[model samples]
Target: MLNVRLSIGISKILLSAYCVLGAAYTYAQSQRVVVTGFTGTSSRVPQEVDAAGSEPVNALPSWEAKAWKGETIHNQVLLQGGTQQQQVSVTAGDLADGKGNRIPQQDLSIGWVKYVWTDEFRDGCGYRKSVDFDSSLVADRIQTGTNTMLIAAGKAQPVWVSVRVNANAVPGDYTGSIIVDNGKKITLPVKVTVLDRVLPPPSQWHYALDLWQHPAAIARVHQLPVWSEAHYKVMRPYYEMLARAGQKTITASITDEPWGHQTYDNYPSLIKWTKKKNGKWSFDYSLFDKYIAFVMDCGINQRINCYSMVPWKIAFRYHDEKLQRDTVFTGAIGTPAYNEFWSVMLRDFTRHLKKKNWFDRTAIAMDERPMEAMQSVIALLKTIDPAWKISLAGAWHPQIEKDITDYCIASEARFPDSVLIRRKAEGKNSTWYTCCSEKFPNGFTFSPPDEHVWMGWYTAATGMDGYLRWAFNSWTARPDEDSRFVTWPAGDTYQVYPGPNTSIRFEKMIEGIQDYEKIETLRKTYKATGDQVALNKLEAALNNIRISNFNQQSATEQLAPYRSLLND
Candidate 1:
């Protein structure tokens, strides 16, 4: 039997009652009957009704999906068939399942899109990705829904991301492609030049360098767009050696005292005071002075992290020993004892110089103590002079880790954009995380946001970071000694593999030169005017350029001697 119910409106019945009654009798009597009816969402509008009328009695699932606006009209009808080779037709408001019953078509359109995809990645792997864009310059009425509507195919496809635009847009032609995969990308080109308004520049880019990066990172940096690759031959020696020693230093060791003594506690004045007072620490700059001289002579930017305020003997216990009473940090660097000591120490460190009147230029900043100790140091330094750039370094864990990250981000906005973490693959009976940097045979863990923790290069490329720390130099070239380096005086020998010397000087040099130039440019352009926005943009651009695979930090060292000219 065929039952069709058609109501045109609240008061009108449009379905042919006579035709349906006769069809029901025929359907009940037929043998090979073909029953067909339309099934889809109905809209209460004259135009949508017309479109529904245009649809065929039977259509494919793919062609039957579309949306129309008007009013609510859930159409329903049914065609029952009992005959073979016999056919019955109906409109979209009708449906039937052999038993002459109407069925809902709601289950047909499954998993439809609700928003358009905006391309954001560049063509390749590491380095190039996010393109600089002003979120306020969108030109079109953006739409988001379960349908994907694109006017073009292949390369002509739109690649631009969208942000709701406002009236004050300084418009002009804006265009670019986001890399999707190798040789595949979507592009959106727009021309919206406004009258009498200046559009932001497409981008401002710069190179970056960190004087203490793995040489592999340095050699790789040379491939970025910002690196002056043509002039990178000067860093050739620095990088080539590292590249040749491509193997990683899988073992990492940290001694209680990397320098074998308190930073400035060995000077004549410090020694005299300590000797007379029976102190555990003294103030001295003999080694510091020599280190500064060596860097100046090497003509390389000096980046270093000072380990501790208290002597290793007094601060961290040796092999889990108790803190000795006689220590450098007997609350002597602070008040009642002397306030000038800490401030004077930094002041003198910054001001100490050779005949050229140039003190050692340092960028590495960190204090490894708890937040309270760090805060005291910061406060004292700020009072004595607020110009010194100080960064706190400590275990990136628990509450203290968050404190460190928060302070760095808010105080200096210096989060590293890229982090390289060496994670060991999981295997049966293997219970350890293996990275190329260090070996913790006894099992060591790093608190995150520590420069050494891996976060990939994405965060760095987008101005969320300013430094990356993965420092390990293969000391196996010292051959007979433990390749797992512990630096000097004492050594930690937990090692996995043996290899040639792994010096990352090349990478460090590259980072240093690039960053120096970048900061210098910012100072030149915005220092006098105090353009924070411009400065932020400059920093962002530099960060992006730093992550680009094409960056040329390998050529960094050779140009350092001439950077002063560029600064001028």
Candidate 2:
């Protein structure tokens, strides 16, 4: 990854990362009584606790853990089936931590007492919500909505009680007072939104290449000293074509090994056994930079620059496999050094962008946030630019959900729509993100989001993500079994009039998607529609694309376990 280390402010970054990641809470108070910041999954408690209490002492207010939410003690697992429970805790900012005060006489929140709860530590290390808060809610996977249950608004979506309540037990709406417990409580009712008409597929999320600039022009760029001409001939042209096809977003990973299909795991290796540079430990991205310039020339919109890799180097050196895997992101590994390094890279990358004048044009993403990494990233971004569009991988240590987001939004105070509503003078209001994504080498892990996040497979709304994405071997004029559009069947065919030799199902998949446009359209316009039938059609259409794409990808995956196989 060629990341710099041990410099000015590195320590500060690390320290902050540690604190922000809940390290402070865990280290100081192992057994914490908490109500806010509970995600159904993908996040964890910095401190560990007991899942069961002694004799099931009662606790009041609503209780929530990752995917499941309830209001009582045994109810966390299930007490009285019909009895209700509420796990009450103070709201953030409403009051300060009652640190150093005498144990005040307790008041039952609608007659509830404090009980013990554990770290829900996914049975081993890191938080994945391996167990359920209640066995009853296991089947409702979609409700997690990307393994998270709620959405929090930053800036001004304040929490106000819609229905009121009396101290005594009664079942009716009772509007009384605002619970100002800032850190303690932050929940609200959601205004469900539905669309009236069908809209066109968004095609800006991806950047494609121009089919016109292939062969000659691209062939020349590959011959330069820093690049492998043949590899350039294979991949570069297609990358360009993908954008030229109106796919506006592109991702350029540095690779030194074989990856999958025509696609090489071509990631820039920061450690040993990398493919390029004759096995240099510290990678040189200079040549890659040139290729990026090529992409820039084509007017690509978004780009994700990642030197981020699992720190196999550190994990092996320290002899901590868990740390090693965490280095690669088994879960959250928030630490000061991680934070320091993360902020360092982000800061440096931000600087590089400014120098190249590509800073404002693209939305930069910091891949896979390690606890340590995010600690520094959050703080650094706050310092450098609070408004910087940032993102985190869905695989961090968390039982995290809407509560945690609620906490983050409240603390960060920025709304999702705010990014959508920024004024011209303010800057771009585009906030793009993905959650619970399939791991590159492995298939998908972690639970899906609360709802079926409409795999919006177009260029714009989804960037380069689409159900009918087409990938042929290469874009060279050379005729080969693998290539998408080749020369010969001859010059004019490959040049002036590009065409597909055989109708590879790739086109059929696109047609399938085109056919599905109606289903998607209907999904938007009507309120009460047929769910099962529409799902079946959507599934059939989507699967046509998935199965087709996978057949191609599975083939790609097999060839080069590392990278070069695709390029060569």
User: Per-residue lDDT of 192-254 in model 2, one digit per residue for the tens?
Assistant: 111122224324322122121222223332443224656454544445434433444444432
Give the Cα-based TM-score of candidate 1 against the true structure. 0.30
Cα lDDT tens digits, model 1, 370-448, are 5555555556656744544443433332333322321222211223323212111110010112122232111111111
Cα RMSD of all models vs. native, in order, equals 25.6, 30.7
Which has the greatest lDDT? 2
Q: Model 1: which ten-residue window has the lowest total lDDT?
A: 423-432
lDDT (0 to 1) per candidate: 0.27, 0.28
| Weakest lDDT window of 10 consecutive positions for candidate 2 | 66-75
TM-scores for every predicted model: 0.30, 0.32
Candidate 1: list runs displaced more than 4 Å.
1-286, 302-329, 332-360, 394-456, 464-466, 474-568
Which residues of candidate 2, in runs, are more than 4 Å off? 1-226, 254-266, 269-285, 305-334, 339-345, 362-376, 392-505, 512-568
Candidate 2 to native Cα RMSD, angstroms: 30.7
